[model samples]
Target chain A: MEEEVVSEENVTPVDEAEGADQEVEVTEEDARLAEIAELNNRLLRVQADYDNFRRRSREEKEAAAKYRSQNVIEALLPVIDNFERALLVKPEAEEAKSLLQGMEMVYRQFQDTLKSEGVEVIETVGQPFDPHLHQAVMQVEEEGFESNQIVEELQKGYKLKDRVLRPSMVKVNA
Target chain B: MEEEVVSEENVTPVDEAEGADQEVEVTEEDARLAEIAELNNRLLRVQADYDNFRRRSREEKEAAAKYRSQNVIEALLPVIDNFERALLVKPEAEEAKSLLQGMEMVYRQFQDTLKSEGVEVIETVGQPFDPHLHQAVMQVEEEGFESNQIVEELQKGYKLKDRVLRPSMVKVNA
Candidate 1:
């Protein structure tokens, strides 16, 4: 009876060891599954972030191309104004008249180039003056003009493809 | 004796079953490790791609900004040429002289604007004729000029920064 009891005891411990081994394996597999789940989530997030970045970069590139000439055109506005003033003066001598004609052709060519680039003069004279398009230098009560009408354009304003470069300097009828 | 045989058989089968379970556990663990390594490699590749894309986008943005005014400047070159021609004429009458003076001031202002925008005239007369900067309209064996030297500039050329808008039309000595 004593030997039998010892044998039974040994068999019980072996069964217990097998159970412990199974439990350890199960725990390890669970941990690995959890790690895989976390990595998948991170990968998805990163992929989404890359997509958003690509979209934003494309939009920025388009905007840069659209407004590429804005800075140079803005700088040339004063030069255009001076050209207009100079072209208004009439020369009497034959030599100066020929020179003036050549200058007029250049001025017209400059205007054409500006137009092709989507630049346009902002209309002011006889039109209603809006603060967005015109700077009111003087306000007056004038006859033969409606109130808020632009009486004169002191200086020209310009627009480039729906963007205003400068406001027109104007006199408005109050 | 039969009972002893039965008990021995049962013990051996249990041990074998435990060994198989342990083998299965090791295989599962190895598979998880391999999966983790693969995921890590994929993540690293994606990250490297994103970094390259960002660098390329930044470079493209910089180039776009640098060459923004190139098109407009090219368009205005002929207009500038005409202005230069008009300015060379001499007026005799007082009225013509005053008109010419106004035109001269405008021309100066225009040139100043061009300079500020990094536009420059390419040297031709007395300089070595380069195909990149000068177009040889005529080749002559002219005296008092070195071989391959530009003797006369038929038309002015312009550069915006380091980029040539137009090559100078020139006469080169053979």
Candidate 2:
């Protein structure tokens, strides 16, 4: 009887071990699938981030192009003031007159440089008024002029390439 | 004898299944480890990309600041030419004389605008020669001047803030 009892305990444990082994097999397969899913999710996130990075780079380049000349122009504003001041001088002698002539040469050189760089004056007079290029401060009914036509420009506007740097201030025919 | 043979076949298949299950378990564990490693690698690559993006943005901003007024300054060159042309006129009448005065006024206005924008003329005469700011075109011996002192400025040089827009051309005292 004791020998039978000892044998029975040994067999029972063997059966339990087999059941546990099978359970481990199933769990192992599930774990592998979960790992694959997690990896795929990470790959997707990285790809998305790469796409955003490319878009931002393109935008930065465009912005850089649009405003590339802002500082240089700002610096030249004082030079413009100097030109105006030179023009205001009333020459009393021949030497002063010659100096004025030299100033004119410098002024022409400055203007030619600006033209070569794609700066254009906005034309407002005798054209149909559009809000994008012109700011209308006054309106009047004028004979032989179409309604909404710009009658005169109070201040000149300028454009660089296709972009308006300053809007024209104008009088429109009502 | 037939019953013993049939029982042996059944036992053989059970042993084979256990061996196959163990093999599958080992391979699954290895695959799990590989997946984790791949995910970690991807995470690292994304982080590196982000770092690069930030660096590029900083570079772009610096470039923009450096060249912001390039276009505007280029455009204004034409206006300078016009000023020069006006100065060349030897006005024979009062009307022409007043126009010259007007031109002088404009020139002064232009210079003041440039001064307000951080544009400065490089001083060369009697100053010690520095290669970064002055381009030496000639060397001459002059009384009461130190060696390497700038004797004259052949052409004006300008700086916008800390950056030199143009280097001064100079004659240095040998």
Candidate 3:
């Protein structure tokens, strides 16, 4: 467009070649119309490109934020298990009584916070085994349920949004 | 183009009558070439549109995955803080000792996992204050450092890739 653009020098050079010529001046209307059309086309393309770029950037940011926790959350799962185990213990001694109470509060808060944050626990026990969410480690023939039903979850599944962050290790009834 | 596209049959009867008198025999070659050209043009546009659509879908998926953790990680920050505090505790008693050790191991692994996943701790101390990474709450005139330099970080900043998740709160040297 820069090379093709009409300049004052280009017009003068061409006009001078036809010496002593009667030149009809281009009208303001024609120039205005040409300019308007060019502007209109450019504006539309610009708007479209901006829209696409906005959409792309937004998606990239979201994807980055989502999976960033994949590694850390999985690493913390063991800690969560330990917390659960400690909380499960009955406070028999005088020293453990206060310690147990504090731990319980921390564990409860952690669970509540994870729940609110879209860290959903995939329910596997007593439900049909799904390959998407469950990994069959051991199969058992159980009564009152379908053959592929989930008998018990050995390790719980976790999800970040619709994507499975971690699949549950389960005992299937198959 | 068929009847639905060209509507050639709807042409005036007079035009057809005029054409019937013409001795010029239009060969099938010209018609086939024209059709091929038209199809090629359509194919090009379709391919371009398909590329655009594919790019859009890919970007959307990436963005969805990225942002899925935004709320989740923010919610888990409190739990992380609790772990950090628990690590700082010196174990003087035997009660809950094993649990503490296990939690410590889990916490270390969690930190390592976050590092691997592009979740970075924004460097805050002993550097020139950058408005992008550091938020200055109070200014202090330090002997060794120049003006607008960070003296201390109040809270660590966090980032994922090039994007800043949280700005570090800092005390700046006057």
Candidate 4:
């Protein structure tokens, strides 16, 4: 009987110690699992963010290439306008005729270069005035034109591809 | 005595079951810990990659803006050369003089626009020949010029900012 009691005491203490150790281990394991879940969520979010950034950067680069010539073309518009005005002068003198011929050749070459770069003059007279492509400088009543039709183009407007570099200055028929 | 033996049998089975459960729990906990570590490493790497990408993208955007006018300017170089040639012709008649004046004004305006965009002509005559900025087409023994010096510029070279658009065609003294 005494041996049995001694054996019982030994087993009971060991069982209690094991129970406490298990409680601590289970809490620690639960914390580690929670950490793993949190880390996984963060990783997914970062990956998605990176993917979005890459796509946006690619789109921006394409747009930059498409519109690369915008500023230079815009700056040259006034120069082209002056060239057109100079070409309109009538040359009566023989010397003036030769100089005018040279000017006309250069002007044609310039136009060809602009055309190759996707530049086009916007049509204005008799067409419907579009606020996106035309700027009305005057409103006039003309017998041969319909309402809201452009009666005359005062200044030429240019577009590069679909982007309007300058709006056409036009007289609108009321 | 029989009851004590029965109680001991019950306790022994419970302890064995608890021991098996603890073993499984420990293994599961270890797996969770390893997963957390791996996920953290991935997150760190992804974040670093994103930082590097953002920096590279910013630099690319700046470079694109700086060189945006490069292609248009290159295309216009031949046209400018023709304009310069036309301006060199002297007008004898009154009408030719006025036409030349208009052409000169337009040419000046064009030059101003180019200058504003950081375009500059490379110096050639009397300057030491530089392979980076000058292309020697003819070597000549010219008087009053040092050896390896540029005697004349056959065709003008241009640069936009620090980048060479074209090297000057030059005659260098042997």
Report fnat for all candidates as fractions from 0 to 1: 0.53, 0.37, 0.20, 0.72
Scoring each candidate complex against the real one, what DockQ results? 0.33, 0.24, 0.10, 0.40
lDDT of each: 0.82, 0.67, 0.64, 0.86
Error of 4 at B54 (Å): 0.9
Every model's TM-score: 0.85, 0.74, 0.54, 0.89
Measured by DockQ, the strongest candidate is 4
Question: How close to the true structure is residue A81 of candidate 2, measured as C-alpha lDDT?
Answer: 46
Give RMSD to native, each candidate: 9.1, 9.7, 14.7, 8.5
Q: Which ranges of candidate 4 are over 4 A from the true structure?
A: A1-13, B1-22
Better of 1 and 4 by lDDT: 4
Instruction: Tell me the tens digit of each residue's lDDT in model 3 across B78-160.
Output: 66667676556555456656555655666666566666656678897788899998899999988888888898888777876
Judge candidate 4 at residue B102 and give its lDDT.
Answer: 95
lDDT by residue (B7-30, candidate 4, tens digit) is 233245456786676456545645
What DockQ does candidate 2 score?
0.24
Estimate the lDDT of model 1.
Answer: 0.82
TM-score of 1: 0.85
Name the docking class for model 1.
Answer: acceptable
The candidate with the higher DockQ, 2 or 3, is 2
Alpha-carbon runs more than 4 Å astray in model 2: A1-14, A17-32, A71-108, B1-17, B71-105, B115-118
Score chain A of each prediction against the true chain A by TM-score and list the results.
0.84, 0.70, 0.64, 0.87
